[model samples]
Target: MAIDEVLADLKQKIDEKLPKGTTISSVEFEGPQLVMYTENPWSFADNGNIVRNLAKTLRTRIVVRPDPKVLVPPEESVNKIVETVPVDSAIANYHFDPDVGEVIIEAEKPGLVIGKHGETLREITKKIGWTPKVVRAPPISSRTVKNIREFMKTNHKERKEILKTVGRKIHRECTSKDQWVRVTSLGGCKEVGRSCFLLSTPESCVMIDCGVNVGSEEHMTPYLYVPEVSPFSKLDAVVITHAHLDHQGLLPLLYRYGFEGPVYCTPPTRDLMALLQLDYIDVASKEGGRPPYSSADVREVLKHSIVLDYEEVTDIAPDIKLTFHNAGHILGSAISHFHIGDGLHNVVFTGDFKYEKTRLFDPAVNKFPRVESVVMESTYGGVNALQPSLQDAEGHMQQVIKNTLQNKGIVLIPAFAVGRSQEVMIVLEDAIRKGLIDNVPVYLDGMIWEATAIHATYPEYLNNDLRKLIFQKGENPFLSECFRPVDSNELRQEIISKREPCVILATSGMMNAGPVMEYFKAFAEDERNTLVFVGYQADGTLGRRIQKGWKEIPLKTGKGTEMIHMNMNVEIIDGFSGHSDRRQLMEYIRKMKPRPERVFTEHGDERSCIDLATSIHKKNKMETRALTNLETIRLV
Candidate 1:
């Protein structure tokens, strides 16, 4: 059936299902949800079966809001809300938005304000014609969260329009279904960055992880111009698996090019991506490079973005449903699972996943409810890419720090501010607590401090032990007294000049840009100093070049491209990486749940991707392939 025919039928069914005298002013889509604007909302909101039956008939989620004409005045609604709530809620602040017909309530304890079974919320809506949206205040005030909220508050009108426009596009009719699903590798194949996969069925088109390659100076972005992705209107949604620049950096460019659909991701992924996107723009400007998008473009992403927790089944495209599972790579990093065409295809994409638990998160969810084919990452898929045990790695790090501190030499660790920096902080804190390493000043540069604060805000997403340490015992490694934030370049340089034997963790993890480059320049000539890498360094990056034993490096500096000698000790701790090692990658496949029938590998160097693919094919006798960029695979 055509889209118009389907919607017409759906509307008729909804009308029949709703009780008599229930006035529906409008019907629209909010993502996959069917939202009805009604003058007589009490007739629908009060009756549970009305919505349940409508949802079953329509085969989608349903939401009903009071029409703007019937909405109570904001001031009047606010007074009643204050009176209806109890004192325990500690309602920090709230406001009413006539457009969405909801009262946004920010409280210290949102659950307390909401009451049991949402009885109070239903009462409020019935009495005052305002829906209540309760949000908990951050345990520690976060400027990023505050700004995101303020942006939403100020743009209610704009956001409402965006939602309506998106809703219409999402529910638009499709006339064809070939009954076959094909995936086009736009990028992140035969390479480790610029990860994008274009998934298309006759029913809809969706893209996953539209990112940029920060390691490249020329071709830094995914192939969004490919015919499979171009004329962007057909692009239904973008599902970001993680917030790494290599995973979501080019997302704003979609908005800049007039792709106004939604971007689906976890809540932490939303905020963290915004932080990195804006920082990328700032870094580009300072380096005299032109970024593809601007701050405003990233803001557009936040406005259109929809956040779903792990395992949330959301209908992103007409024939597709998306579920995100913990990838154990980073906070909010996910393994993207797609269930397409009512069992026609079930595909899983391991977006840079780790199979083992770390100090930060549980391992990637291995037992999905359903999967027919899987796309896996091969970042450490080579036979020789084995990592030492975490205990040994931590012991080595302690020894390195102890030796460096005794030698009165600085220890510079270049890390991704989001995941690696926080893990290293916890490792150092543990070493100190265990009396294994001496107390030394730990300085955080780049975005580490702000990122650490963001990590603290999402304790529930972390591993059980870490969550217990934080929410249960009220202990957070991020708040350690030894860690100090570095705010000024002058102060950073001053510390370098003072010949301080401190441990400094800064970005970028691969040393393509950021304060890590500055620290490397200042300390590179001193053999007493050490540079330790706790993360993957993409090929052709400064980190890779340094790791390959470059005695001399040509760097773009204030003096305009100077050549510097590297006499410092360079060390790499493979065990500290967020990615699983070769052994873990193989084990990940070996322990598969109800073993997939086919597999495809990507997101690594040519050798690793091919090696892993060959192993999977031979070991399990499963149909598998090592895909390259622009390769398209048809799965029945």
Candidate 2:
């Protein structure tokens, strides 16, 4: 077909598939390539996947132009589609290098063309010609680790200066010279998880979210080994944002020290914490003595908890009012909003949030009259952490389970006692009811059964659609007949000993610590048994070691310690990650109305944190910082 015919055909095909309010403005031909430029390509953000899928169906390549000004090739066929995009007003600073057949586009805004893995360059090349290698005007010296380090120090110094200015403005309202308030992070300055902050005024001292680092065991102190002489204990309240271990794991240990204040969180957070702490205890017991804390201590911590509803703001102390908002990470998980002082200051702690909606939670709420400072989780700080769709995750999980059960082989699912375990059970139960699997016993050991009961009691905390399905439709996926809750240690041992082909779901998803170890020891030697991990496992943990395809595990059993040979199958389903990916995090930050003045990236690896900080500064022009453990930077 001629170029004009191709352009007309492409326009017609796109118009047919697209919903209302989209139209192609024109088409053009550049060299041998063809392009169909659209006037309204904002739909690409919402239906990009659909466009790509349609392209494949039509046996053509479709590239959504990121910029509207880029000229489009008109010769592209409707059926033999080349690419389409929005034309932006910006001019390309650098074009392709003809010597290497590389597309070297220079950028005034260098971040956009580089995207999350040079996606912008890839898109341009897919639509135009060869993959473009982006190059900018060279500096006097090449960019290196040394240069970047200097750049960061300079940036940090500048940020501190800016912060001092802001802090002075904030402190200007102090009525008394002796009584003043300043803000600073106790831990997690740059990264996401393990967010704890210290807010001090002459009349009040408050600490929020006593969290443990999930990334590394090299330095895993709950508060970076900060000594608690009296200042730490004098705090009015130690509030937890959610039940995720990174957020709530270390609260019990606070009671081990001299601190004896209320451990405040949601009611479901209380119940989930018990389940998590018990599992933590069980894991520590198997690994030998000196576990973090005992079940007794956890019980003590629970007694000190003051459960508050989402919108009901409760005064924890004379100077602090606390409220919980749906974080959308998991059931009962909350983004803590603190109204400090008498209309003095407000700070929000997003424990672990999901801004985008998911199968089990609502989107993160962003409504507050005042929010002076915000602490957020950065688990997906690295670009790679973004997730596939919920449907894809479920479908992938279904396939893994279905394949494992087909051979009548035992499928051992090592899941966290909290959210992941419950989700997997629901998926399995649905599959079984759908007659997708053979009649096989499905066992629920560890704290999962108890956790499910807690989940049942708190329907309002769950996603709106899920609650409606359970309450209105009367569908009991959690209480399915196939799910046999192992009530006692003896029952668990019996189920492990039984030679039945079944699906066993146990706690401590990482196998670092939980009942999963017992089952693993019993079945590790059997080739028919499959171990599936659905969450991130810390390094040096048993789960991480096993997932790396270790054939031998040194384990201490009831009889004694011994090195066990293993032939069990192992797999990791990565899409179920609750934390947002790097892409999602950036988008979330970009969308914040009246954007935050500063960004601290954390809850990720060193590389992830550094990369995230760079992105924040480059893309948003925000003063982003990444701090090491125990490092403190005064806001004033």
Candidate 3:
């Protein structure tokens, strides 16, 4: 069927289902959703089930919006909203988007803004004829989130058009009938960085991740020059599994290269991805290096983003239906599940998943409706790769901190801004509250503070224990008084000069750059001070070098290169890792529902990948392979 005819038929079906005398101004597609603009917005007030039943019949998501003519002016609507909502809601801001007829209401307490059973929201909508979308005002403000929201509001028209274009493309007819599925590893196959994969069927082509290898000077970007991914515009969509640089760092390059498709990710991932990309550019400029893509490219990527919640199934292309499941490695991290060609096959890609639970999130999801082929990460799949229990790890970390602090020395923990930083915060906060450690100042440098602010905005995405602590018990660990934000060189200098006992968390987890390098330089020669590694350090990174007992390190100085003697007490706590160890990786495969027929391992050292594949094949008696970069395999 033609596009126009299909839309007309859908409109007719909708019209027949709506109540009599109700008029729909127009029915339009808006990126995996059918938006129906109604002249009588109140028609849906008493008959909510009408739209629900229609969605069930159409087998697509439906959204109801007031017609442009029905919506009141922004000035008048703002007044109505202010008068209707309770004063105790502590509304922070109001943003009006006429393109979508939505008034975004940011408040300290969104529940109060929504009222009991959405009564206040309905009242505001009825008063102004604009839908009220309530969002929480993060306790700690995030500049990245603020900038993105403001940009979105200012460019509503352009964003709307982008969504419409994406919607039309997704709903277009598929002309191919030959059924086949293949996957190509453009990078991140017997290595841990620059992760990219191409999943292709006759009718659709999707890129799973486009990342960078921050540690390697020779190989920085994924193999976009490959014929399968060249001209980047041919990709139907790009799905990001997480916000780590190795997972989403190089995404803006696609926009720079003429790709105009939507990027799919969870809400937190979208925000964090923007933060890290912008930071990447800033770092490069400061370091006298050239950035591959500009900030304009990052904005383009954000404008074209379509955020999806966990388990919400959406059609990305004519032959592909995509769903996200929690990956437990980081906030907003997901395992991509693709249903292709009318259920001909299902593929699951576990992107940097942690099979065991952490303080920040639940364990990665293993159950799926159906999965015939699986692509998994083997970052910690070596034979001796077993981590201590979480309890032991926490106790060890606390004891180390105590010993350092009691001796009047600072503890420097080089952590990633996203997952490991936040995890350490929670652990430290709990320890302080329980009097397990002194209430010393915990300093947050680099992007750790900003990243935690983003975490505060999405408490629902956290683990159940943490969520309840935030929502029910009113104890948000991220907001503990012990934590301090270091925003200037003056404060950093003061902290180092004071010689006080404290714990400092700095970013650039691998110790390649960022504020952690400065702290490492300052504390490296102090035998009393301690350096902790709470996360993985990729090969070729400075952190990995230190892990391998490189005592004399050459670092750039103001005058010339200087060698720094590392005398600090260095500790590696394996249980704090976000990636699953060998045992957990095997357990994930063993517990996976409806066991897959074939498994491919990636995202690890060459030996680790090969070991994992060999172990899985021997233990489970299933076909397994460890893919190398640029290898292509046909599944069906």
Candidate 4:
């Protein structure tokens, strides 16, 4: 049957199931949802279970919206919302999107706007004829979030059309019945960067994690030239596991190559992906390198994004149901679980997961309804890769900072702008509050400050302790007074020149670019200063070279290359990395509910990947393979 026939059958069934007084004006497909426009939306308002029952019976998500003809004017709707919602909700802004018949209310306290069991929201919708979408206003303002929200509102019509097109394609009739699933590693196999994979069935094709390697020019992007990945438009969907450049940097390149499918991820991941992609272009331009994709391509990606919360089962293709589980590697990092052919097979891809808990998030989820094949990362899966406990790592870090401050010297810590920066901030704040370390100035340089602001915006995604501190206690560690933002080059220079004992956190975690290099150049010759490594440093990066005890390093300068002597103290505090170590990886597999029949290891050095695969096969008596780029494996 054609897609129109399928939708027609669904609409007829829906009309029959609806309440007696409910009248359907139109039925439309919006992405994965079937939206019904009604003249009287309140007919079924007394019993919310009607929609749930319809959804279960149809085996698809359903959304009911008032017909546009019945909707109140934008101005009148805004006035009614303000009057209905309490003043203490701290409504920061109101945005009306007529295309979706939604009035977005950004407030500091979204619960108050929702009222008990969403009574207030129902009242506003019934009164104004617009669905209320409540969003929490970030305590720390985020320019990226604000820009994305504004762009979404302004382009709602275009976005709605895009969704409709995608919805038609997703719900299209499946032609083939030969049920088989195959996965191809386009990149991020026996390597730590450029993570990409292609999952294909007879009915649909999907790509996961289009990434780039910052440390390598020759092997930067995924194997897009592969025959299986060519004609990018053939892909039905693209799923991003996180906002990290290694997982999503090359996403915009898809849009540049004529791919118009929806990109699925969490809300924070969408915002952070935009921020990182724009910054990637700016950094490449400043460093005199050509960016692969233009800013316009990034904007296209934003318009096509479909944000999903964790554990929300969504259909991106006719044969696949995608569910995201917490990975605990970063804010919004997810382990993608694909249920294919209505449980004919299930594949779980662990994208750079941290099986152990951290200050920022809970440990990676090991439980799933069903899984047959597992593809996991082996970033720290080498046999000897054992890290210290979190408590010991924090203690060591605190002592190092304390000694550096006591000696009246500055401390430089190069951390990833997203996860590591926020984790370090929490640790430092706790140490200072407990008097374990001196209360010295902690300067946030480069994109760390902006990334920290984004972290503050999503406290609910953080660990339990941190969320309680922010939501209940009203004490956000990210807003600690000791952390200061360095926004100007002059301030950076002044901090470098001054002998004041302070702690500095800068971005470009591998020291390939950004403000960390400026501070490193200034502090390299100071014997009393300290440089710490709190995250993974890829090979060929300046950070890795320094870790190898390179006494003098040549660096690019305006006048040419110059050599700088290294005299500062260097510290490598283990256990702070977001990647799970070998022990944790093995333990995760052991603890997994309904153990997988086979496992594939990737996202590590060649030796690490091989070793992990071998160990898992030997210990669990399961088929295991360490795949390389362009290798295809048949799972079903």
- Which candidate tops TM-score? 4
User: How much lDDT does each candidate structure score?
Assistant: 0.86, 0.63, 0.92, 0.91
Candidate 2 vs 4: which has more TM-score: 4
Give the winner by lDDT: 3
Residue 15's C-alpha lDDT in candidate 1?
77
How well does candidate 2 score on lDDT at residue 3?
Answer: 39
- The sequence of per-residue lDDT tens digits that candidate 2 reaches over residues 45-78 is 4455756666566433344432344323323311
TM-score of 1: 0.92
The digit string of per-residue lDDT tens for model 4 on 1-636 reads 887888889889988987777778888888988988887766655567988999899888888888788789988888889899999899999988777777899999898999998889988988888878999898988999889999988888899999999999988888896989999999999988999999999999999999999999888889999999889999999999999998899999999988999999999999999999999999999989899999999999999999998999988999899999999999899999999997899999999889988988999999999999999999988999889999999999999999999898999999999999999999999999989999899999999988988888888788888888877888898898999999999999999888689999998899999999999999999999999999998889999999999999899999999999999999999889999999999999988998999999999999999999999999999999999899899888
In lDDT terms, how accurate is model 2? 0.63
For candidate 4, the lDDT comes to: 0.91
Candidate numbers sorted by TM-score from highest down: 4, 3, 1, 2
Superposed model 1: Cα runs more than 4 Å off:
1-26, 38-57, 67-90, 115-128
Error of 4 at 75 (Å): 2.6
* Over 4 Å off, model 4: none
lDDT of 4 at 565: 95
Which of candidates 3 and 4 reaches a greater lDDT? 3
